[model samples]
Target: MAVTVISLVVAFLYGGPQALFLCVILGILEVSLSFDNAVINATVLRRMSEFWQRIFLTVGILIAVFGMRLVFPLAIVWIASGLGPIAALDLALNPPPDGAAYFPNGDPSYETLITDAHPQIAAFGGMFLLMLFLHFILEDREIKWLEWLERPLAKAGKLEQLEVVVATALLLITATVIAPDDKVSTVMIAGALGMITYIAVNGLGEMFHVPEEGEEPEGGPSGLAKATGKAGFFLFLYLEVLDASFSFDGVIGAFAITSDPIIIALGLGFIGAMFVRSITIFLVRKGTLSDYVYLEHGAHWAIGALALILLYSIGTHVPEVITGLVGVALIGAALGSSIYRNRKIAAREGEDAVKTSIP
Candidate 1:
């Protein structure tokens, strides 16, 4: 809260009251869109020791804010435009006077360049998130928010490497059928890397986190599979990748609000990302996941939706508002179910207590 207030004050100084207002809106939107992220973060974070958790909140935020929001975008522009690092930074700092119209012989603005690169960006982030959602769908969990849907999916998971086969097919269709003729290879390559990254990080963590001869495995009922040393490093990398995937949407979406990269870095990275980390820690400390039960299921569902949305955005424009709303709706439904279940259980327990008293 203090950080939020301070940020707003700083924003006010930066561009007066209007900038302050924009910051607030960006913060709220980011938090809403990232509700699923907090849930997913808690799932991974609880497995880490307190030391790593601190690293996540501190060092992780720096990478998320300055690295992804600022430098990542710049890097994208740099590579896409084939410009030197300093030239790319200069281009970002001085976007074209008007985004909608291009001069006959002028270069595309920073916003235009980033917007043009959406297909590749979407390809990479979408596939990574799709793999995440697929893993959750394939896992055999005791709890299910939508059993009618999840049970059949779980049964289908018996097939060997089914997720990989399905993901590859989807990538091929998107690349060949959906992508522009010129961009087909770009989409395929980016999406393939996304898939490989997910597999390598997730597999390494599981492979290395095996318990030593004496000790019980650490992950709780959810089968988180955690460890220190190399395992922790992989887990940390996984978390960073997860953040990058989540931020892809926000980074692109912010252009809809403002094209100024500096303001975006401040709004999304400084205030918005910080709030997300705080929410993750709060969920971990409160044991919210253990209590809510279906919350994690909802988060994964939201992620699946987001992955599809990202893939769709490659061919068409999608409003950022829709993306944020979808996440909030799934999470809200799961929370409602959890509350109802808790009440029913409490009522039954009360009846049992009364019967015992009568005896």
Candidate 2:
């Protein structure tokens, strides 16, 4: 309620009632596009301590809403345009000049600036997300979803830093083949930084992870032991990066609705982000992932799909609706599979109990 009210007020202040409507629409669009992000976030957030969870809800909200939605875009524009922060803000608020090539159809707008930087942004976000998906799929786990593909990847995981190698190869191929000649360097650098950022943050998380004294380190450490103070901090960083990677697509897609940065922030930030955070908390508290065992598998697969879409988007424009639908479909299918598997298990257990009673 507070988020809706605040969003309404912000929209009104930015551009009257019409702006309010657009803001609401953008908010809905963001929520629809990012539902999978909420699921993935819940998976990680469930591992952190209560204190870290609270911080994610409170402090993290501030960063997601303001840092990523507002300041991040402005920072991008500033760096790309070589404008001062104030000038960039002004550029964002006002329309573009006549005959400006950056603005599509000669319409000067902040969206133009953001659109112009899409290649680099897409490269960075795509590589980071791709690496994340690879890490999840390649790691040896008890539950295997697509065994035919994942099993081989799990075997390959035996090779040292194989995920990193695969990700680097993909980045190089993308830059060399798909990216335009003029933008090749920019794409390569951005993609490399994305991979580096993932490795650094992931390493930091592992470094801080302290296994419990008596627990066997099967997969490094027990969840409880791994959620220490320092580990939680690094986990927080991981979640933030994950959120940022998801937001790259959302932010770029928001332009399809409207170019006003304020409206985009009000829509995506106040409403969409608040909803995602709430969903994450709800899933954590309810243990949704545990109940639906395959849900995590589905989410990771969705992430893999999304990562590919982000990478392909660098070469061509993919509609936001298509991206959202693909994720939703994967998650929905996973839920169905989980339900089916649960029913089968219950039936088998019932039959066993009946046979024992007869004997």
Candidate 3:
């Protein structure tokens, strides 16, 4: 509550009452877009130790707010303009010159700089998310959704690192066919980096993971043991990467709503990130995935849709509303399916109990 009040005050002080209102709207927009992210985060977070969870709330939030929301944009500007960090910061704070090509009204704004870099950002984020979705679907699991498609992928998973191959192929195809001539190299490079990041983080997590007794070597342990220091360290890295990937769209999308870096950081960083962490913890405590049975499936499908949209966006302008709604629709359908299944089971159990009583 205190943090929220302070952030709002800062927003108001920075840009008056209108900025404060925009900040609140941006925060809500971020949360709405990232509901699927919360579900996906919970899926991995439940496996982490309590200490790590605390770190996610504290250290993770700082990185999300300051590092990605603030520093990252500055770094991008620096790289793009060959300017120093201080210069980039100045550019972001000061409005773009009048009649600039980037803004709708030819107003000079930081939004122009960030929007110009969208292709690379989209390529990187798209590939990373694609790999994540593919990894989940291609792996063998007890629960299945869309088995007709998933079954083949699961069978193909028998091959070592098949997901990497598929991701590479898709990236190549996207760069060759869809990317503009000037942006081709940028797309390829960003996409490769995204894929490499996912592989490195995932490998590190698996390297330190220790299987519990009687666990199948392939199945691995369900969760990391609190005593294993290395396990916690690598899991922390994985979680951070996951959070960053989830933030990619939100960070980019936030620019559409506001050009002010301070407002963007305070709104999306503080409110949206805090809510996501809270949702993760709530899901973990309630065992929501296990109870629903299909929620995880829904989240992954939503991820797949997001991945495709990111890739498609490289060639065309896809509205943020469409991107967000696709996820909500998939997750909503999954929840409905889960409720129906639960009721059916309850009805069968009740019938069996009544028969036994009659006897």
Candidate 4:
């Protein structure tokens, strides 16, 4: 809260009331879009040690703010536009004049350059997130939220490397059929890298993870496992990458609100990212997921929707609100279901108590 106040005050001092207002809107937008992210983050974070959680809030946030939101976009522009580092930074700070062509002429703005590179960015983020969703849904779990659908997917999970095979096939189809001819290579490469990253990080975590005595080996991504040592490191890395994937679309969409990178950083990166970190920590500490059983399911479903949205975005434009709303809607339904189930359980317990008391 203090950070938000300071941030808005700084914005006002720097760019007047308009900047302050934009910052607030961007911060709100980021929070709304990433509520599911907080839930998912809590899942992995719960498995992490307190020290690691502190590192996540501090060091990890630095990476999210500057690494992903600020520097990464600048790097994207530099690569796409073939500009010097200093020049790229400058172009980003001072985009094209207000009335000129929006993209790719003699002097394209940073937004244009980065937007042109969207195919690769989307592919990479999309494939990674898709793998996450697939790993969760396809794995056999004792608990099932959408039993009708999850049960079948769990049975299919018995097939070795089924998730990988499915993910690969989707990537290939998106690259060859959905993506433009000129962009096929970039899409394939980026999407492949996304797949490889997920496999490596998740695989490393799973390989090093040691279940406690009598504990059944987890069949899913192993996020439920309280990993330590090398496994913990990989889990931390996985969380960071997951954060980057979730932030990719937001970082880009912020341009639509304000071209100023500083405001984008203040709104989307600092205030917004801080809130998400806080929310994750709160959820972990409170063990809310244990009470609301369907949240994780809802979050993963939202992730699947987001992954497909990102992949589809490579070919065409999607309203940013749609992405956020999809997540909100799925998670909302899950929360409702959880409440209903909890009430039903309580009622049954009450009835049993009455019968026992009468006897």
The TM-score leader among the candidates is 4
Candidate 4 deviant stretches above 4 angstroms: 99-105, 210-228
Q: How far out, in Å, is residue 357 in model 2?
A: 1.8
Model 1 regions more than 4 Å off: 99-105, 210-215, 218-226
Q: Write the per-residue lDDT of candidate 4 for residues 246-338, one digit (tens) a residue.
A: 998898788778767888888988899999999999989998898999999999999999999999999988888999999999999999999
For each of the candidates, the C-alpha root-mean-square deviation to the true structure, in angstroms, is 3.2, 3.0, 3.1, 3.1
**The candidate that achieves the highest lDDT relative to the unseen native structure:** 4
Q: Per-residue CA lDDT of candidate 2, range 1-359, in tens?
A: 68879889978987998999998887888788788888999987877899999999899988998998899999988887788899888877766555253566544457777988888998999999899889898899888766788799899898888888888898888888888888899999999999999989988987876453354555755666668567888999999998999899999988777777788888998888888889899988998988888888888899889888988888889999899899999999989988988899999999999999995
> Pairing residues by index, what is the TM-score of model 4?
0.93
| TM-score-sorted candidate list, best first | 4, 1, 2, 3
Estimate TM-scores for all models. 0.92, 0.92, 0.91, 0.93
Judge candidate 1 at residue 267 and give its lDDT: 86
Off by over 4 Å in 3: 97-99, 102-109, 210-228
Which of candidates 3 and 4 is the stronger one according to lDDT?
4
Better of 1 and 3 by TM-score: 1
CA lDDT of every candidate? 0.85, 0.85, 0.83, 0.87
User: Model 3 Cα RMSD, Å?
Assistant: 3.1
Residue pairs with backbone atoms closer than 3 Å in model 2 (clashes): 96-108
